[model samples]
Target: MKLDVLALSGVFDTGLATVLDTLATANELAAAQGWRTQPFDVRVVGLRRRVRTALGLQVPVQPAEVANGAVADWLVLPAIGAKMPPGLIDALATREVREAAAHLRERHAAGTHIAAPCIGGFVLAESGLLDGHDATVSWWLGPLFRERYPKVRLDESRMLVASGAFVTTGAAIAHLDLALWLVRQVSPELAAVTARYLVVDTRPSQAPYVIPDHLAHSDPLVARFELWARQRLAEGFSLDVAASALATSPRTLQRRIEAVLGRSPLGYVQDLRVERAVHLLRTSRVDVEVIAAEVGYANAVTLRALLRRKLGRGVRELRARG
Candidate 1:
């Protein structure tokens, strides 16, 4: 496949490398297995011929025109890294991002398939290509994405979402999933072999890894609630109590949270509890029961079940890795 890795300015260095190197590795594995899969004809392209990544690494890329003229069967958008929310907001409004959206619109109109990982989805969404189409973005950016692109059905929970011509993945590392998906589309057999060689596990969703605390700062009411929730996580506070603490009506509190965070108050608190439980599990040498109680769970059994159901991990397994 003729693939163009469209690296915009301020792109995440790791994301660009991940897509290119993983696909190259997949090709090598297929060749070793004597499979006759067509190798990926991948070129890194940018709005400009060159750009600096967020880490200040200089990367050379083909001019935008290189992606045209049937040279590209698929256009890949890698995530851009921004240190702060303001940084991301600034990036989305930049000429580089807008040019990327325009280029993607043109390419899609010309029948080129589009695949974007994490924040790259913003570029595609800006083009209106994902309008009325189901898409996925980094879970932490869920609120901003929904606010900016309401017409596009945003499913931030999914690890990957494929809506016809477009394929989008969540989380920064989801480029791994996107690469495997692409490899599979060409040859499931090769994809299997490649995955085995790479030890790429099947990750179905980004929900478990989402940290509500980090996302709460986007809205003031939510931020205040997050502070209150964290203080009372072990005690368990009711929604009405939380609203009163924040000096807002329960219904309005719910409304503000739902509008920005896309999570119910209950869901938000549960996620908070789980996130704290995970930290204790990974960093603490204490018993599971103690850790569970510390996170407001009554017992280890409940926490264990939540870990398994949400993160697809066991207590023993998490500790061993930690």
Candidate 2:
């Protein structure tokens, strides 16, 4: 499959470099695997007919205006800077750019997978590809994006979020995650081989943390459950209750919990509750029994056992440290 890595001018230096490096690694892997790797065809298309790097390197590109009917197997937009290029900005403000974005969106909707890193989400969002879709961008730009594009859901915690054909990364070096994910999607064996070639030791998986701040509100059901649980910690919070509120049975809810979070409903809830209790114990003046009840534990004994199992710290030790 031919993959097109389209690099835009004024793209973030760090994010762009990471994406290019990963793509190069993938290309190398594809060549080694005897897959037909198209070099010139894996293009860097210009939005306004000319592309210039922030460091003054000029890149001549086949403008997007002429790319209609292009059979692109994969479309990638690397991370862009917060500020856009003048020519590109003007193009985006024009009818042609709007139409081009629309065409790209249609192709994407028809099952052409797309990957955008960091601020490149702006491009996808402009194409209306991200409407009502959960995604992550750099943490610093989250508020500005929310202010500008009220329709697109912004997540800041996750390294990346896959919504249909579109995949987006957050700030920092999330390009690594984006590239790795694309490699896996295109060819798992190729991705693994590439990872080994690059000496990269790890892969992106859901980190064990309460809320995972980047994706805290990615899922409405989980977001609402978290909000409700926070406010009603003392009100006999249970998986059944949460499932009922979401209009799903416990079994269905458990399945979703495993699918999204890789954990059972009760297990996830208990972890959240333990996280809360640990925070309360360390930060609050509340006594153990009250804090236990506040976090939905029935009694000190059960709470202690849970703390030992989950927190790995006795309640007394946790409280004493603070």
Write the residue-wise lDDT of candidate 2 on 276-313 in tens digits: 88888889888888888887878888889988765456
- Residue pairs clashing, model 1: none
Candidate 2: global Cα-lDDT?
0.66
Location of the lowest summed lDDT over 10 successive residues in candidate 1: 62-71
Candidate 2 Cα misplacement greater than 4 A, ranges: 36-41, 65-68, 83-103, 106-111, 201-322
Question: How displaced is residue 312 in candidate 1, in Å?
Answer: 1.6
Screening candidate 2 with a backbone cut-off below 3 angstroms (N, C-alpha, C), the clashing residue pairs are 156-214, 157-214
Steric overlap count per candidate: 0, 2
TM-score against native, each model: 0.85, 0.57
Best by lDDT: 1
